[model samples]
Target: MDGSVMQDTDLAVLLHQVQHRTASPEIVSSDCSASPPAVLPKRVAAAFASTDGDSDSGGDSLLRPKKLRKPTDSGGDSLLRPKKLRKPTYAARKEEIAALLEEHRLLQARLELLRQNVGIPTSYDHDTLEAAQRQQRAMEEALRLQQFALGNTQSLFSKHMNALEPNPLKTYIHLTTDAVERRNTLLSIRREKLHRCYQFVHERLHHIPETSPYHVEERYVNAKGDRIISRFERLLFPGVQDVKQVFNALLFYLTNMEISISETLGHVTVRDDIDAVETRVSNHRVVSSTSYGIELELNAVHCYEYYEKFEEMGGQEFAME
Candidate 1:
């Protein structure tokens, strides 16, 4: 067998074995991490020159073919390799994914807004806001309740007071009765101290004449500072004792120690109702001397000596006892 033919036969056998294998084609590998080989590009081939024997002259070298690659003029070492596009990518079905992502973003925003709204206290902020509102409402309600209660209390108080008012005529009448009661109680008391005090005051009792013992004397002063005296009769109501004057003067003289009745007694004389005179003189016991002047100014108020001492009911305390 010829050597060349034997070499050719071996090469053919190897090629046949490689073509029959079931494995699919492999992608081209690159060491520089350049893009994967494209379908077509400018091809570079290895060159060789032939040396002519015995001289520096050269003949054409063998034309070596090279594997083609894709080219890019862009200023990048490499571009991202596109993955082999699948059915989803090839069909361009991305609208649904975009919509889902958008919905998710919206949900996050809604959750943030819900956190700001007031509700049952899950946190301190919510608790504070709710408590403040509750307190404000409670204060308003309390104020309203207080006003209502005040109104009701005022109305009730007024009604009660009105029902309990004392009558004017009965008021003075009651005062006189109380004084009589005091006198009787004091007299009845066996206590020597109380009896002595009551008797002393009791003797001063006299019916009050509208006229007073004191007189107002008016004097006119000249520029030289000298004074002139105008003497007047004691002012009197004619029938107070019914005797007019003389009897009042006698009683005044007899009862008072140093106290002098006004001199008007010398001018007017005589009387008829001895009992009336006696009654007037008798009513003056406790209050007459002190209260008389005040009575002149206080017309609206009528003064009566209601009690000289306590009533007989265990001594005297008029209103209370």
Candidate 2:
């Protein structure tokens, strides 16, 4: 009897400890006085009767089923349905949209150009060019001929020949067709015979008509053996200026010479120095070099023999062009 009582007491203590609520006698109510359960085991009829009926009473509440809706359906359970209309996502960045638009625009432009390329005809074809030519000929002259006029050499040389302006590196072509040019040529031929090579004719290199660029550029090394530029601002240019001027002045006078005759009726030229060199030239008429021509002409009373020394120095035959 004592072991059975002890076992029952331990069982009651174990059941009480499993529940969180206190196992005090005051909390235990008499289930016989309570109402019966809705649906439960009969062995625990008192416990079910003791349970609050509102909590686990209905059989339908225990196996409650969730409703499912098909994609085509729009009635019950539609709130959990797959959407027919696609929603716009706000996560796309601004740069992505702009890039797509730019690509689309470029594609459209390329398509237009391709369409034009297939259909459009060019106006530069031979037929179009020939038509233009025909029209131009009918409107204007049918035949075209090129004509050339020549200007006076003295005037052209003085007016147009500026060495500094063309910068020496420029290309120059002197093609003239005129009476003055012809006369200048004759004068040049005559002067060449005067042996300008020996300081008797063109003493300065620039005295030659094309000599500005034609003359060799002399490289002068200083005491320090450094190359220097040859220019008029330095002493060399001043020394050479007169020689160039004399050539010009001689050309001017010779090209316009008069065919004067003496009592003997010789073919005596009345140029300033036309017959002076070829004839019995006065000592005063000769030039030391193109460099000293101006000084010689100015002091014509005492000009020296310049050509003899040059003639001795393996000199070339004088020009009689």
Candidate 3:
């Protein structure tokens, strides 16, 4: 029995030591790098801790809230997407639209004013006005036709003059002799005719004083001793008396004539040769005849077929009364 009591006391001492260790809090070092970690009581460890709601019991609290990683751009697909357009505000363009509307109103008012100002006569009968306009147009057309007829009459004279122009090639072809030789002979004859005409005029002015209208004085006194000055005074009509002037007048008169004394006397080859004595004198004869009141007679057969046709076509309007 004594031996049993000593064993029970020993057992009670071991139970008390265990209770004391459990009751006292363990002093664990936070610096666990230098010393080994103090052993924890395996009885009240993680296995016994609640894992359902307590966030501080495990390493869950230390983990950061993972930022949601943005989706990466897959290649050119992002660039190909159409950009969304921003909505436009009506307030921003309201003033411009108002200005346009105001302009339209002003334009409408101007158009109305213009329409009122142009006062067209609406009282006249349309057919009467049309007939009056037609009569006025006909009168205007008649006046235009009269003016055209007058213009054509004036142009007819010019056309006749143009027809009288000589062709040099035709004249050359007509001459049988060398053109240069004929020209030289014609020039000599012209010079002689001009000298003779000048002498005749000079003699007539001094010798035949009664026939000539001009009276010439042979003697005149000036600062220098007695000058033999030919002072010619015209007692009749005013006329050119110069040799060159008289020569031109004679040629103009004789150029179109069929017969003349100069032509009969002059041994001329080409009819176009104005320097021939016949041509020069023929022109002079015409002038002399015209001056002496000789009437030019015209004797020709009448063929009025073309003239009748011309008169039918309104040419009678251009005829002199």
Candidate 4:
């Protein structure tokens, strides 16, 4: 009977302790509801939730899903937005008009200056001025030819000869049929002489060594040493016996015919006529050739002398219709 009573007492005390523990939580919850709940700092709550592993049951309510933030693009927004264009102000329009007027004034000034420089009168039309210039040039050319025919060598046209202006009067005087025939005959005789001289020089060069100098270099050495003399120098200063004889014959013909070598290359051709006589001396040989038109003119004195020589040479005469 004593053991039963003790067991019932222990059982009742354990049940009362269990009921008290369960009711104590309800009372605390009701008190928390009745008053305002205690606010925890965000950083403290986050630290407590992360550090305490058992906080899932209680702290899950404190952490609502973080509100997602959309990414911002300022540059893209600015680009997508339409730009508002401002209307031009009265002052800006006035400035543009002023600048255009200034440019117009400058262009007009330049045009006026150009007209003055070109000697184009404001009253004259451009085509009229051009026609006048053409007429003036024709008159000048006519006057020049008249002066040239009258034996005026100091004419304005002759002064500008270096400017490459062709003289029609000179061409007419030198390129006539009679002039061409006489010049061709004279040139043929000269050509024959040149050929003979070339043959002699070519033969002489063959007899000399390859090392023998043809052109003048080191005057003392060339004059003293066994160097070949150029035809030009031989013609000018005849030292060798054979060269003197050859040049003497050429001089006699030149004097009798009254023909002068006016050019450095021993060519006598009319002005404005293209004539070339190329002669290259190298390697014991003389290669000479001529090209283009050959023309010349003779005075009355020379013409008589030329006919006399032609008769002496027994040239056949032909009548021109």
TM values, all candidates: 0.21, 0.20, 0.18, 0.17
Q: Candidate 3: deviation at residue 27, Å?
A: 99
| Model 2 stretches astray by more than 4 angstroms | 1-90, 93-99, 108-297, 300-321
Better of 2 and 3 by TM-score: 2
Q: Could you list the CA RMSD of all candidates, in the order they appear?
A: 23.0, 22.1, 25.0, 27.7
Candidates' C-alpha lDDT:
0.40, 0.42, 0.44, 0.44
Report clash pairs, candidate 3.
262-278, 263-278
Model 1 scores a C-alpha lDDT of: 0.40
Enumerate clash totals for all models, in the order shown.
15, 7, 2, 0
Residues 1-321, candidate 4: write the lDDT tens digits: 999798667656654553343345444343322322136344334433353343245543243244567657986688788998776798789999999999998998888778878986643466788989999999999999987777665454333532332312122223234655645644444434444544555554665554444542221123235332223121233364543355346535434332234344455433221222121110111222224445444332111111212342255331100
Tens-digit lDDT track of model 2 for 109-157: 7876776688754433446889988999876653332111233554454
Q: Which stretches of candidate 4 lie over 4 Å from their true place?
A: 1-103, 106-195, 198-224, 231-321
Ranking by TM-score: 1, 2, 3, 4
Q: Candidate 1 vs candidate 3: which has greater lDDT?
A: 3
Model 4: lDDT equals 0.44
Error of 3 at 137 (Å): 87
Clashing pairs in 4: none
